[model samples]
Target: MLDYALLAALAAVLRTGSFDRAAQQLHVTPSAVSQRVKLLEERLGTVLVVRGQPCTATPAGLRLCQHVEQVSLLESELRDSLPALAPAAAPATLRIAVNADSLATWFVGAMAAAPGCLFDLVIDDQDHSAEWLRKGEVLAAVTASAAPVGGCSSHALGSLRYIATASPDYLRRHFPGGVTAQALAAAPCLTFNRKDRLQANWLQAVLGTVPSPPTHWMPSTHAFVDAALAGLGWGMNPEHLVAGHLRAGRLVELMPGRPFDVPLHWQQSRIASATLAALTRAVLQAGRAALRPAAAA
Candidate 1:
């Protein structure tokens, strides 16, 4: 029989990424947690974790942690429903991984709508955030990849439209034909970082050449938007984030009707917890309302 304390320790170790941090969180000594995990691994006859600077879970460890999380959530729900339990501390928190563009645009609203739940958000590029889910760092993620990670399920959230945008003054000075490859290559460009290839990808798709402009890397999504609004250079702007600016003429959509669509997906561990279920429903509801309609036949 598996001990709940050991299971809790396993979950904590995975969550904190280190034995020392898990010990601090659990108010127990690291040695004690280590013993508990060793005992648990012996009983299960499987290697549960990879111990290093930042601890990682083995496949078995991932499964065990997911089970522990589901059990913890269920217990919390039961305690919350009881008369004297003081609401059970919000189901031990729901950790999420999301792309920066979504975080800058619609994700904050979805999070705001989640009452009585605590969230730990890990933000990364849409294409890469699902890696966190695979590593068992987050319970769910908003990702660009349609393929689910191991032991996870996924749903399409709809496409996010991005327009190549610039301030009108920047357009007048640099982009005469709105943004041909030749113009983009010569103009200064703004990007989130070196990893941000949205501009390069768009240019290649439209004009069969990559833009090798003088680049500015503003890593923060909000700051990137602000820099473009300040006419720093042309950047790919999510339609939702720039809608008001475009309408108010603070920013101009250089490509006008031409837009690129990146498909978004919601990926989550296949665990049955009311908290996760509720969060999934809320995110899907918001996605339906906020995202563009699916591609037509």
Candidate 2:
């Protein structure tokens, strides 16, 4: 009973997060897309979208959009197999959400392997990137959470090891032996932007008190690593990213024997698109090669 054209338009609007971008992609005026959505909502007797600066789908809208995306993907697969039925162009854009750290490290290789697909990368913390998937902002995500978002599937990528690290000069100038509760309170620490509290959390776990180190806010993951290497302050760095620096003697691991492990997951929508499926498999394969094994039971 639903109009396929209107459903496709709705899916486009939800995917792009704005009327203007969806219209541009669809090669129609923004007004025309808006009219189509309005008509569709009227026919369905539901408020399907929350119109704002960055648009969001209502719960009903999300369900409908998911259905539409699945159908679209299925159709694309069928068309791909039947050359006579194939569309002129394959869907070129794939929207994905990834944490800043993963994006800085192993994710680039997976992306490089995806030669023909255009990517829209949404960067957020691993802990929260799945929310973008739930809202239909992205079709897939690299997240810390194991729980899959609704209508999505998840795979355990592997553990991302974090080492408590600082520059040799910082260690010499501050907590010379090793970091302790009292020493950490007085030291300067580097943080990856405002939302990063891993350093503080580690302090709390070890000492039962949060460190009140004078903080330097370096937002970029790469920059945060660089700042730590430059002896800005003590912080947790992803082991892989800091491996070279540690070997080169540019940085030193503060706690050589103990390391924190953060598990990573790859979450993707349940849509049956061959391209998405292939991409997911490739990422998982790459992750298994790159990451540490699961902790023993």
Candidate 3:
């Protein structure tokens, strides 16, 4: 028999990233949270959480959290089916991680359509959002990873195409000659953040060895494109975002025919529940309509 209180403590510490915050959430003292975690570690004979400013869970800890989440989901299902056991609290909020570009483009549309349920949206880079799911920070995620999380299922949403683009004036000033590896080394570029490698990846695909150009970080998806249109820097813009500009000859493609592809997937915990199912269905339907079926032009 596992001690659920201790398990809850472990989950809270991992989720909140601090014992103090976990204690606040659990309506207990920080000392109580610490003691429960310590006792749980002793009982299991394995350390679950590594103490730090923002704590992280070990593999064993993650497994335990997953189990707790599963049990909670099952209980929710049972409660929903049996109205007599209904809780006084509001509906459980479903937390999910999503990348910025998707949110800026097609993801919000899906979310907008998914009404009547509470959502806690976690924004992160597409490549790394899976780590949130792995750590049990989110119940679901839209990630570039094809490999599913431990207890989650994955469904392909399709490829998000990116085009290496620059405003015509910026290109003329930076590369009087055609886009070449030498010219690329000198031009400033726009990036979402330090974690964003879309620019680097696109440059590498074209230039063999990547260039080290100074970058202006515009973290917002809309701001990132706006910076490019303002001739601040060249960056990999989402194909759809640049389509109108490209057609109007405002932005020129570095590689006219070849576009970078990032295949996205909807990954969620393998629990069957009404809310999760409805959310998944809405996401898949919207994604299929919005994203490119393939990388090609």
Which of candidates 2 and 3 is the stronger one according to TM-score?
2
* Alpha-carbon local distance difference test for all models: 0.83, 0.82, 0.85
Q: Please tell me which predicted candidate would have the highest TM-score against the true structure.
A: 2
Clashing pairs in 2: none
Colliding pairs, model 1: none
> TM per model?
0.77, 0.78, 0.76
Q: Which candidate would rank higher by lDDT, 1 or 3? A: 3
- Give the number of the best model, judged by lDDT: 3
Compared with the true structure, what per-residue lDDT tens digits does model 2 show for residues 55-135?
888988877886775566566667778878849344556778988888877888897776656677888888788998988
In what order do the candidates fall by lDDT, top score first?
Answer: 3, 1, 2
Query: Model 1, stretches more than 4 Å misplaced?
Result: 1-71, 78-90, 176-178
User: In order, what is each prediction's RMSD in angstroms?
Assistant: 4.1, 3.6, 4.0
Give residue 72's lDDT in candidate 1 (0 to 100): 68
